[model samples]
Target chain A: MNKKSMYGRTARKIGCYAALLILAVIFMFPLYWFFLNSFKSYEQLFQFPPKFWVWPFRLVNYLEAYMYPAFDFGQMMKNSAIITITSVIGAVLSSSVVAFGFSRIRWRGRDQVFVLVILTMIIPTEIVLTPLYLIYSKLGLLNTWFPVIAPFFFAKPFYTFMLRQSMMGIPVEMDESAIVDGCNVWQRFTHIILPQVKPTVLAVVIMAMQDQWNNYLEPLIFINSNSKQTISVGLTFFSGMNATEWNLVFAGAVMVALPILIIFVFFQKYFIQGVVVSGVKG
Target chain B: MKKYTVKEKRAIRQGLLFISPWLAGVIGFTLIPLLLAFGISLTDYNFLTKPRFVGLENYITMFAKDPLIWKSLGITFLYAIISVPLQLVFGFLLANLLNQKLKGIVAFRTLFYAPCLVAVVSSTLLWKQMLETEFGIINYLLGLIGIGKVSWLGQTGTIIASVVFISLWQSGKMIIINLSGLQAIPTAYYEAADLDGCSRWRQVFYITLPMMSPTIFMNLLIGLIGAFKTFTQIKILTDGGPSNASLVYMLYIYKTAFTNYKLGYANAMSILLFVIVGILTVFVFRTSNKWVHYGSE
Candidate 1:
């Protein structure tokens, strides 16, 4: 409680808060700037000292982006909604079920197979792109949502691994007692194991939704037809156009990014927890 | 083969049955395609015609004929080497700062992480405007400081740096990971250090770091792997501009497949890319024992 050390401690705390506040602004500025600029007029955008305040919120660029016949932001939204919703469902369901089998069930070679799954996670998906393209084409699934949606129905290694870790943490007695009581494997999975790993399940849902919603590469590669394409590719075309409408591009970006941003804001706890679990126990 | 108890047999049956979807996926998606990818690499296939066997030609073309492969590979490595270390070290530093007991720390963490949640396309689009050669905000800001316009995404001299700049704010993921790792360490360690008269820096080096080594090493491995696959933002911002100076390896493989209709050669390049990634991953794993500390008491 000496004055000198106390003052030094206060000074350090102040400096810490100041540094964090400054860094937060630096980190958040691009997103803030992007949102603000989306509301500016072309004249406002072109001005030397760019407008910071979003006075008189501009709706024209948003409308123009939406009605811009080629891009069709509405259809893209529907496509993304379908893909994200279905992919989330598939990822959560499959990852949970597979993790149960891998974790709760004792089988010969299970550990080895689980190790293989984790190892394969390191292989970049690009390595499989060319051959998968051919396979999809031969299956006549190109220009269809099937290719985009089918992969998630299988246990993605990372999600499966994470869920398995959580599932394994539950005391063995819970599931074993259920098993002795004539609770079948499926019953054990659904009634006992699944309920225990609900938080991880929520985590899986967030990640799967995030992955599919922001997914640009797979959709671009798989879906060739204009009508079937997702929002990311449509927005890419807007930005890539030589004579770009900066306002419209910003507006389009806002449209693509806003939904997930809202979701992230609400479920910030789960998102942080999800990542922590993945890292700490991973 | 050894016989199993009926109960054990039932358990094995249930496990396999439950993971059947994944097993099916391995055959339908991964196994078949991967085996076929190796097969395709030894041929000359375009979408239009049959794959004519051209044994080792694509591999030769990759190593000997295509100089861009080496250049793009070098560029990708440079990108990974630059971006990933920043992601790890900066993320750890920021995490340590945020780990301090403070008011409204959650809000600060969220704000820092918001950029990472933005759609890659949107984030890239935002940056493309901010870095546009003419009428760019960055250049406009620079004018106040008496610096000339520096064509960030245009010139070869600064293209990688420009791409690296956009990626800087995205260390949010690493920050979160590091923060969690930091939080997981027992507070008793720090308390003990204080009781022993350890300086703040000494406590960090002696207590926090050794405890956090495994987590930091995980971030390094994941960051490097993710860095090598960086494509979408660069594709949107520059599209390998200024005569392909910014072309990362995946972008090259993509173009080689879709644009040039060299499916066979593209598949070959992809396998090589995988080999490179595998080697790097193994290399990191091998080095982990030298630094990464396992669980403590």
Candidate 2:
């Protein structure tokens, strides 16, 4: 283009970079600060000017955090892993099966039931919290992991809808070809549709795992025993008990947050794509 | 009416079989609990005693006598109003920036999006420390500029603002969604705008904004609902504290049910919350047609 427009373009690019740099720093500051403080001693942590960097990194903070007397961080991590893995597997399998039924079959009431599935998305969980709690209590499943993990086996509407939408985009001819090869509905679903929607299934798996890992309120309410708590709830109680020790608190926070962060970093493409699909489709 | 053949009957049966788990879940977990919640809302159950049918007594008390309900609702509305738009604007602006072709853009995007992955409990606890009046880095930085330290979570005036600030800090998901919307806009439109000698500002106002309206609407709806349902952060950070100044609705219901053991009253609060959210969602959907542009239409 013209010289004036070229200069304007250059200036705009520079300005954009500047703005982005500032925003990036602002966004990353909390995590950075948290990490920096995690290694600081109590005196260093409470220093008036707030030391930008710890003199000698106290890795013992992590050790203390892990061995905190009030709650066992190792046990908490195990509980979190168990809950997250089981729930993700349950949600993925159940949601995919239900999605296949909705998208692949032409039942009389299919559309009507799918509409009900969509409607469930808008109903806030608060409405069912009390009664669900009572039902679990009545069933004598209150303190167990059943309350947290069992619901996923039933199929969450949001994940079901997401999977169904993606499954619908898979060509019908694949299922038809499978049927011609003497495949029943279940075989076709397993052999054709499941393989086709593997990417979306992976995305759903990661999202479900993230949700289960980060879930707080459910664990807080249902799993009252300190030993049974997930990382999220356990960390909160840890922080409360060690409120004065900022180093331990930050250490516990880091431990609680690290796995999800690692997952996001490694699987960012799927994560970003999942966010886009959900946003656009909704 | 056409009669179904045997083949069609099998397909129907198989379909039902596939979806049976969901049906069972809906019956046992969702629908039954919802009906039971409505029933409990009309009673005086405290989890320790049998639910005595008081017949709308909880709702009546909430409406007529309980002032915290109104105050908490007002606080929640304020939180939603301020935080949703703030997040939307920040997300939109950042998305526009990230849409540019640049080196290391992916790294920048990841950095910005990382906060969204942080667990709410941890993030709240981290922020609680960072906003501490005496030892917080925030006040330390303010002190450097000759500004006095402010009790971010302590003061009534600053409590909501602090909550909003922390919420906005995790606007990464919104940014990702907005970036997708931005990238989805056809580049041909911008090229055409350039051919017509349109200014960048005019192009954004006329073309980009309209094209992105649907995405914006989606973000707005999600943001509104999310802000209203905010619990873990407030509960961890302030515990609706410093005189209940930051008591959001969900925290109120949670405290009422769990801490006070007033299950019936909490259910009443929950039913009210559900209706309010439903109405707000319908209102948005109704208004969306006017402003939310679809490319096909």
Candidate 3:
């Protein structure tokens, strides 16, 4: 390469690296801010030149956030756990079963129904919010977890598509062999098919967990009672008119966001693989 | 294999049985709600009162009478158009950079992706603090640069800009998706370009650009759809304030339905949005064939 071209390449490379690093810092700083702010006392939080580090690190905010008005953190965590676990179970089981029908079965109008399922992806959920609210209210399911959890029992489109793609990758000969062994479809599903797509199933579980744990709008609109409120909604109370307490709010946010962050960090390889696998198929 | 009647019936039965739960849920939760929403669009239904047939009055009023409806729709369009292209371009650039070999690349990628994983509500709240006029960090930084404190959220122009900023930041996920697509391109293309004495810009033009088109197309469509439906950020950040400059279509529809108790009007607005989004999506999908290059024929 000519000296000028070499210089140009070096400049470009340096430029690219610097830009990415800067953007990354900008993206990450707010999250870092929340963590650091959660530990700082009220006066320290507003200090000019912004105290990057503070001594005598305080656990008081977190504890106070937990203990304030009977510190419903444990209960809220339990609620999130229950919702996430059940939703994941429901989403995986139902989507897989539905996916089997879509991918493997040759029933009449199956393609049509599958198209209908895909159609749901394009429409905004807000459009249906009112009608759904009416229906849920009429069914006496409002203020209960039923509205939140019932959708999972029905296959979500994304999950259904994910499992269907995974199932399609399995050879038809496997089903043929199972049939030759005089195994029923259910037995084949349990012994052969389910095990083959265990990773995809785990992917579905993790996704469903993340979605439900962070779910805010649905619970906000649907659940009215404090007792039924999920952690997402529970944390919203901190930002209410009178209190507007930054310290406690950051603590609550940290509490709300930590579990999913930890889960993502630990299982990111699986999650990224899952995303790529699903995306490539789609 | 013996094609026995009973066996065929049993397999079909099992298939239906297995899929029955999903079928039930789709119809119950999704299809029924959609249909009811369509039906409600024709009536004067609020939550409290029984739905009375209005026969397109809601839609007529929305289009012909309600000026706010148009303004909000305009805002939604603005938000989608402004943010989607910026996201695609920025995301593409980021993905291209990250596609290179670098030290601590994994850590850098993870750091970039972390903002996406943070709960949006929490992130919005943080942005709220950072943008606070008097004591916010952003303005504080601005003060050093000899710029006076600008009300980021309180003003019309700044509020929309702040919402756009939040949307742009959230584009990191799509950037990762783009990165994956970029990496999927084979090395042979670049090698061939090099052998042809192709310049960097030309190689990107002839090879990377065409190969990544399908992913770009997908991202664009998804981004457009996602942006049009944006509510959480608008709700948290500005609440569609300062003379409704930042009021998005969904937030408008939401207020119409829940706050104003105008379900019929809301449904009409929704149906209008639904049609607009659908038309745009189909247009993109149809035109995608022209621009998007798939690996397989």
Winning model by lDDT: 2
- The residue-level lDDT of candidate 1 at A45 comes to 76
Candidate order by lDDT, decreasing, is: 2, 1, 3
Tens-place lDDT digits, model 1, residues B1-297: 899999888878988988887788777777778888899999999999999999999999889998999989988998887888877778889999978888887787778778878778888888877776667788888888998888898765587787777777766666876887898788998989878978999998998888899788867877888888888877887888768888999999999998999999999998898788889989998998898888842
Residue B62 local lDDT, model 1:
89
lDDT of 1 by residue, A103-174 (tens): 899998898888677666766777788898988898898889998998899988778877887787789999
Better of 1 and 2 by TM-score: 1
Clash count per candidate: 0, 0, 0
Superposed Cα RMSD, model 1: 2.4
Each model's DockQ? 0.62, 0.60, 0.47
Off by over 4 Å in 2: A1-8, A104-115, A171-183, A239-243, A277-279, B1-20
Ranking by DockQ: 1, 2, 3
Top-TM-score candidate index:
1
TM-score list, all predictions: 0.94, 0.92, 0.89
Model 3 docking tier (incorrect/acceptable/medium/high): acceptable
Considering summed lDDT, which 10 consecutive residues are worst modelled in model 3 chain A?
Answer: A273-282
lDDT of 2 by residue, B104-175 (tens): 887888888888788877788888888889988899998989999998998655887887888788777678
**Candidate 2 docking band:** medium
How far is each candidate from the true structure, as Cα RMSD in Å? 2.4, 2.6, 3.6
> Mind giving the per-residue lDDT tens digits that candidate 3 earns over A231-260?
877776775456477778778888888988
